[model samples]
Each structure stands twice: as C-alpha cells, then as structure tokens.
Target: MSAESLTPTETLVLLTLLAEARPVSNTELKTLGPELRAASRRKLTRLGLVATDTSVRPFTHELTDDGWARCRTLLGADTPPRVAPPVRAVYTLLRALGRHLDRADLQLYEVFAPATEEVAPVDDTSPTVEGRIRAAYRELAREPGAWVGLARLRSALADLPVDEVDRELVRMNRLPDVHLNPEMNQKALGDHDRAAAVVVGDTPNHLLSIEVA
Candidate 1:
C-alpha cells in the first residue's frame, strides 16, 4: 500500500525500521521509543511493510522490499537501498540513506509537524519537577493548534519521575490549552543518547503525550 494508505503510527514504525539497514531486534526497536509497540508492529507486518524473525526470544525485524519502496517514495529519495542504518553504524551504506533525510525533518513532513508559531522564550532547564513541567508545557504549547510527542516532553522534563509527569499532563488537560494523549509517538526519540532514558533503561510499550497548543 501507499503512504496515504497507512496510519500515522504505522508510517512512523516503518520509518524507524527503514532507518536501520540491518535486522534490529524488537527490543532495540523499543529502545527507539514507545510507538513501536507489538500491536503497531504486527499491523505493519500484516501490511507487508516490516518483517519479523520470531525465532529469537526478542524478535528481530527489518523492512521488506515493498516497505522500502514505499518509504523511499515518501522520503523523495532515489537511492538504491530504501533503508538506512542507525546513526551508530560504522558502515557507509546506511549513511547514504541519511544523505537527503533527517529524522526530524522527515518526522515533520511524513509524521507530525510542530507548530510554526513562535514561542515566548522560556528557560526550560529548571531543576525541580514542577519547574521542568512548567517549562515543558511552555515549550510544547506555543501555538493554538499543534501536537508534540511524549518523548519530547520527557526530554524536556529530564530527570523527573516519568509517571508523575504523566499525571501532570493529565491534570493540565482540564485547562483549555492543554490536552493529554496516552497515544505514543516515537519519532523524536533515539538519536543514540536517548537509549538510556527509554523506560529508564527498559523497553516501555506505554507512551503518553500532552498538547498545549
């Protein structure tokens, strides 16, 4: 199927797999972020975009040819291989896929685009959870209509109890400008440094996001 035929979540999973030139374990996939859940992956597999090797305990996966073709078309790349290796790969082939594509830029175009409205300059490097939460809301909620990812919000609130942050987002939903989504989006995650923060060093299937735009 074409890019238009896939859901936003499905598209994201495919792109993540496409970023990896080698077979990535589902465990490593989880390290990418929370949106790559088993259900989303299963749906992608059913659609013939991703292949899984369940023979191992933690199954490994890669993009199928059709999946690569679709992702390349969406990415507007004419390269021979449709998928690129993770940024950590030493091989040059994977870097070629990244030649024209940036994870953030692709995320905005094919997945979720952040608001263009300029935000009031707010210092988000607060030490406390409350301060961090306040800063995160300010950072993520500058526009009247836009969406931000949970992974981003957490990065903004670094070192806080993730669950507490979740509660805070839900609490803010009562306000007119704020909304909380339990739905997970992994697009902004996994630039190598984010691996440790993934579920506090464990794979987290449940992801939550807040919108203040």
Candidate 2:
C-alpha cells in the first residue's frame, strides 16, 4: 500500500508492530493508548498492509510480507532530516542499516541493544546460528550490493568502540554462508545506503568491488 493512503494512526500502528516482531495481542496493543489500534488494524487490513485472523480468541495480528515492505517504505519516506538531533539521527540510521542487514543481523543488534522496551532473545537461547545468519542476509538483501562492503559495514558500527568494531566485523563476516545471495545486486541498494556511505565519508574501493560468493 502507498504511504500517502495510510492514515497517521495506521502508520503508527504498523510501526509499533514492526518494532515488536512477535504477535501482539489486542490487550497488549490497547496499552499503547493510541485509541486507534483496532481501527488502524481494520484500515491496514483493508489496504493489505496487515493480516488478522480472528478465528482464535483474542485475535492475532501480524504484518504480512507486503505489510512489512510497505512499512519499511513508509518509514524510509518519512525519515527526518539529517540535521535532526543525534539520538534521532542515530535511530534513523539504525533503521536504515536494518534494511540492509539480514533479519538475524538485525535481531543480533537488537538482542544486544533494542531501541525500544522490548527485549530480544537471550544469548544461547536464540535461533540457530544459520537462522541468525540468514536473518542478517535478509536485511542486506533490502539494500544495494555496493554498500555491503567492509568499510560501509564498519560505518554501521560507528557507535561501537574501536575494539568493538573489529569484533562486529568478525561476527558479521562469519554469518552462515547460507544467507548470502548473488541475486541481491546494485539495484536493491536504496538512498539510505548511499546516505550512510556518505556519512561515513571513506569508501574503500576494494571493499565496494568485492563480489558475493
């Protein structure tokens, strides 16, 4: 669905759900005090931005694949200006970064530092190594191939200490091979990737030219 057609409430609702990956009960949503949770779900469903199965009690709401994609697009469209406060800019950058990494990679970062009150799975109790790695690649698939190099990847870790940067790179490099895909080429790279690369301000020629095996 197009962002222009989505009401403010629907947009907020979808963003809330995206922040919380698991299924959210109606009661849980009500606590958000948005007053439009139910209405937003109904509206989003009509727009095919969300799926609801009232077959069971309490109802279950989850964003469909299309819903998730639409949400990402909307969020990208509405991103605040770069000159915004540091905290807001950081959050914006993280969301943009999430678009390029795999789900596992996103989850790993969230597991270590969730932006919201939600908690990620504890270490040792999370998904299999392959599962996490595939998630990371899924995130990367959302971006352009040219931005998935060591330098660009390192910039995503700028908030970390010098020592932590190497650690993160090591971990990212070792993600399960199954997650890598040759089909995610340059076209998939979005404006956010370019902006991030620019912000980092040091593109390594060798890293940008490397091909995925």
Candidate 3:
C-alpha cells in the first residue's frame, strides 16, 4: 500500500504495528486510548495493510507484507544501512543475557536498541538492505536466549573491515542498549567493562573500556 493512500489514523496504526511485530488483539487496541483505533483498523483493512483473524482469541491482528513495505518507505532516510555483525552479535548477547536476566528485560532492551541498519543490496530493484536486516532481527527475536559472543558476531560481519568493527562498537555504545535510563547506561557500560576485564585481566581492554558519549 502506498503511504499517500493512507489516512492519518491508518498511518498511525500502521506505524505502531510495524514497530511492534507481535499480534495485537482488538481488546489491546482499544486499550491504546486512541479513539480512532476502530476507525484506523477499518481503514487499514480496506487498504489490505492489516488482517484480522476471528479464529484466535482476542482476534489476532497483524500487518500484511504490503503494510511493512509502506512502513519502510515512511521510515525513509531516518533508517540506517544494514550492518550484519551487530544484528547477530546483539541477538547472541541478548540470548546469553537472558539466561541470567528476565525475559521482560531482554524484550525491553530489544525495543530500545533496535537494529536499524539494513544489508547492502547486490543489485538494483532487489529488496533494500534494511529489509534483510529486519528479517535477521525477526529471526533472532523468535529464538530468545541464543548464546552469541563478540567472536561469533564478528564472523557474521566478515565483510566489514577491522576499523569498521571498532567504529560500530563505538556507535553501539552511544545507543541506549537497554533504554535511555542513566542506570541502564551504567549497567551496559559495566557489562562491557566486565567483559573487557576478563579478556585483558590486569591490562584491561582499553579500547572497549573507553566511555561512550
């Protein structure tokens, strides 16, 4: 569906559902406090951007593929280019962290530190790199608590140069890994520090230890 074809309400609903991949029930939609939920749903349905299934409890509602395409278009230049390493690495890290943390915490972290980069396209007219990146995140999100480390993440990002790895790490640190809370920032930095400590012992992984802005 084209963005131009969407109404204001329909656009809002589409954006919300795109950001949240899970199936939302009609009841949940009502609770969103938006008086336009019903109206928005009707518009989206007409545009073939959403589908409702009465077979499921709460009446499962999910965005169609066309819906996501329109969302990507709306996302526009704000979207980052696909970077494979971070997607793999973040998933692995989240899985490992989940073994020791709560599932809610992991989900919260994913929401805050969303993977923005899309994979580079091999040819014109092919799916944009971002689509592939989104697919990778979906794959990882499906399998919570899958263990991955820096080494494994690096392997997935074999196309990136060594300098790019450093750059990516710096960029990642600047992002809110577990939300924008100051406490979360401290914890994420602490986690990185601990990981570096293990690697460098008394020497310390100075590069990793550097504070992120």
Best by lDDT: 1
lDDT of 2 by residue, 1-213 (tens): 444476545656666666654456677666752344566667778877777878876776766656666654553454444433643664476577566555443322223211343222334434444233233433554443433443444454445454444333333332222121221355755554434332110111113221232
| Candidate 1 lDDT, 1-213, residue by residue in tens | 534465545665666665554467867777874356677777778877778888997888877656766665554433334344432232243345455456533321222212232323335564545457655655775553345556666777667776787545533433434443323456745553343232310123223333432
Candidate 2 achieves a global lDDT of: 0.46
Q: Candidate 3 at 90: error in angstroms?
A: 27
- Alpha-carbon TM-score of each model against the true structure: 0.34, 0.41, 0.34
Q: How close is candidate 1 to the true structure, as a TM-score?
A: 0.34
lDDT against true structure, model 3: 0.43
The positional error of residue 5 in candidate 3, measured at the CA in angstroms, is 2.4
TM-score of 3: 0.34
Give the per-residue lDDT of model 3 (tens digit) for 109-172.
Answer: 2342224433233343345332322233334332432322333344444465645554344334
TM-score-based ranking, best first? 2, 1, 3
TM-score of model number 2: 0.41
How far residue 84's Cα lies from its native spot in candidate 3, in Å, is: 38
